[model samples]
Target: MSRIGKKPVSVPAGVTASVDGQTVKAKGPKGELSFVVNDEVLVKMEEGSIKVDPRDDSKDARSKWGMSRTMIVNILLGVKDGFEKRLEISGVGYRAAMQGKNLQLALGFSHDVLYPIPDGIQITVPRPTEIVITGIDKQQVGQVAAEIREYRGPEPYKGKGVKYAGEKIVRKEGKKK
Candidate 1:
């Protein structure tokens, strides 16, 4: 019933995967990661690949089947190659910098917004307007990026704020007499 669930996830070189009950754990050059699948979804490893299927034909089980499979695949890839997110800061005087272990943001505020870097996650400011967040755990990397972007999300008017790279913001027109 699920196309994605039907396909097996192959284990890449230099990476190891194991299945325990409803959880799949992967260890690789990047780091180690694990995903706990839903009870309705069954997970197993075979022939150096991971397989997922629904335990029943019910709607809830079917709905979690594809998602569970995808989560397993994400953990495997994350352990092998890790994940990365890029953010771009726009507008005058708006920029980002790293002070020790904290990310300092200048977003037209009265005070600089400081964000503490979390363990296992790396935050780099290659340029004043460019922020790169990298981590072996996809969820953590995305959560950190979201937190950073939340500080000053891009606005429609003038499109001035923090936004994901390659993100397009729909511009809003100004009022005229």
Candidate 2:
């Protein structure tokens, strides 16, 4: 009954995919990734695509059906094309740079914040105010971006902080005279 689950996830060229019981693994030009589907959902490789369905008509099974399908799609795309997230720093003395393999951030703090880069992920500082995060796993890329932004979130009054590219900040009125 899940609309998304009904559609088969096609295998793209230059990528190889396989299903082993509840686990789906994909290897592509970008890298290799795998996901273990919930038992409530059934996964199988059919023809040139992957299909997901609920094992039963229960609510739990139906709830996991679409999510399982989407997870499979993400892994396939991740291994093939990877993912990217960009962050922008805005402040009087705020900036970012790559020190060896660590990301050193100066967010108007007393001392610089050093974030150790995780394996399978790359962080680049093209400019002092711009940070680019790239990785094969979509979740990891997003998590790293969020963690970086948490260091100095944008303030509504001055809008000075680290934020995702294209993000809009809601401003508040200043003190009345």
Candidate with maximal TM-score: 2
lDDT of 2 by residue, 120-173 (tens): 999999999999999999999999999999999999999999999999999999
Candidate 2 structure lDDT: 0.95
Mark the 10 consecutive residues where model 2 has the least summed lDDT: 68-77
| lDDT by residue (tens digit), candidate 1, 17-123 | 99999889899999888888898988888999998989989999999999988888888889888899999999999999999999999999999999999999999
- Which portions of model 1 miss their true places by more than 4 Å? none
Cα displacement (Å) at residue 159, model 2: 0.5
The lDDT of each candidate is 0.93, 0.95
Model 2 spans > 4 angstroms off: none
lDDT of 2 at 15: 93
Please give the TM-score that candidate 2 achieves against the real structure.
0.98
